[model samples]
Target chain A: AQSVAQPEDQVNVAEGNPLTVKCTYSVSGNPYLFWYVQYPNRGLQFLLKYITGDNLVKGSYGFEAEFNKSQTSFHLKKPSALVSDSALYFCAVRFRPGYSSASKIIFGSGTRLSIRP
Target chain B: EPEVTQTPSHQVTQMGQEVILRCVPISNHLYFYWYRQILGQKVEFLVSFYNNEISEKSEIFDDQFSVERPDGSNFTLKIRSTKLEDSAMYFCASTPPGHSTNNEQFFGPGTRLTVL
Candidate 1:
């Protein structure tokens, strides 16, 4: 079975400083990783994804993620954090070659990111 | 930008009652999905629909759960019987065709269901 793990339940970073949220996964086949952000009382917003391209993948809201195959990790990163960026972040993984039986996109437990001003 | 839209932002119902959560996905999308999140819990995928039929479903999607695309633009999830544990924020999502690469899913605000 495929699964994802977000080691941190919460992460705190000062505004204007760089921020990193860690994520790792376990899958039998190639992994399709993605990051999403959710604000209070709102739906989840897609951030970025890692398919089979360059290691560094850039996404919405000045966010990016690095796909490290050897480490089995895809960590979200932002060079400069903003107070408005505070939200719950989720890491998801899916298997390529179409895992329709298992419904690709198994999400992690989620990480609460707080940007301190 | 176009987005998925859900109706009945909040619904309160008694146990054993039938409730249907409605959603309007982005035009021209071919795939639809339903997911639920309990308070303080991870999001769980209930089912996925494509071409007017259920392509995949999870264990959580038992006999009590069903999905239908009554119209060209509307997708609905119906729970035959409401259970206490069913109380949670139900999200509806959709994706376009030939999108198996990253499988980016656009979500709606979601409907908060409360079972009494």
Candidate 2:
């Protein structure tokens, strides 16, 4: 079974500092990794994804992620964190049996990021 | 820009009662999905629907759960008999048709279901 792990339950960062939310995944084959954000009383918002190609994938809100094949990690990063960037972040892995698109996404437990201004 | 929408932001139901959560995906999306998150747990995939049929489902989506797209726009998930453990936030998502696995799903604000 494909799974995602976000080891950090909470990450506290000061405003204007760089931020990193770690993620690791396990899949049978090449993985399709994604990052999503959720604010209070809101839905999960798409952040970014790593399907193939360049190891570094950039996404919405000036966020980016690095996909390391050997480490099986897709860590979300931001150059400078802001107070508004605080939210719950989730790392997900799409299960594609035989590379089919008709599949489900398995999400991690999620990490709560706190950026204090 | 178009976005997915879900009805009844919150719902409260009794055990053994039936509850239907509704969603209207993005107009041009071809694939729809349902996911749930228990208060402090991971977001889990319950089922996926395409062309009015279930393309995939998880073990958590058992006989008690069913999905439907009765009309052209509305997609729904019905729990025949709700249980106490069924309390969670249910999210509806949709993705446009594309080549292999590169598409990202757009999600709607989830409906918080509480089974008393």
**Which candidate achieves the best TM-score against the true structure?**
2
lDDT score, candidate 1, position B48: 85
Give the least accurate 10-residue stretch of model 1 chain B, judged by summed lDDT: B94-103
For all candidates, state DockQ relative to the true structure: 0.60, 0.71
Q: Scored by CA lDDT, what does every candidate get?
A: 0.91, 0.92
TM-scores of chain A across the candidates, in order, are 0.93, 0.95
Compared with the true structure, what per-residue lDDT tens digits does model 1 show for residues A46-104? 99988887999999999999999999999999999999999999999865335462244
Model 1's C-alpha root-mean-square deviation from the true structure amounts to 1.5
What is model 2's DockQ versus the real complex?
0.71
Clashing pairs in 2: none
Q: Candidate 2: list runs displaced more than 4 Å.
A: A99-101
Binned by DockQ into CAPRI classes (incorrect, acceptable, medium, high), candidate 1 is medium
Error of 2 at B14 (Å): 1.2
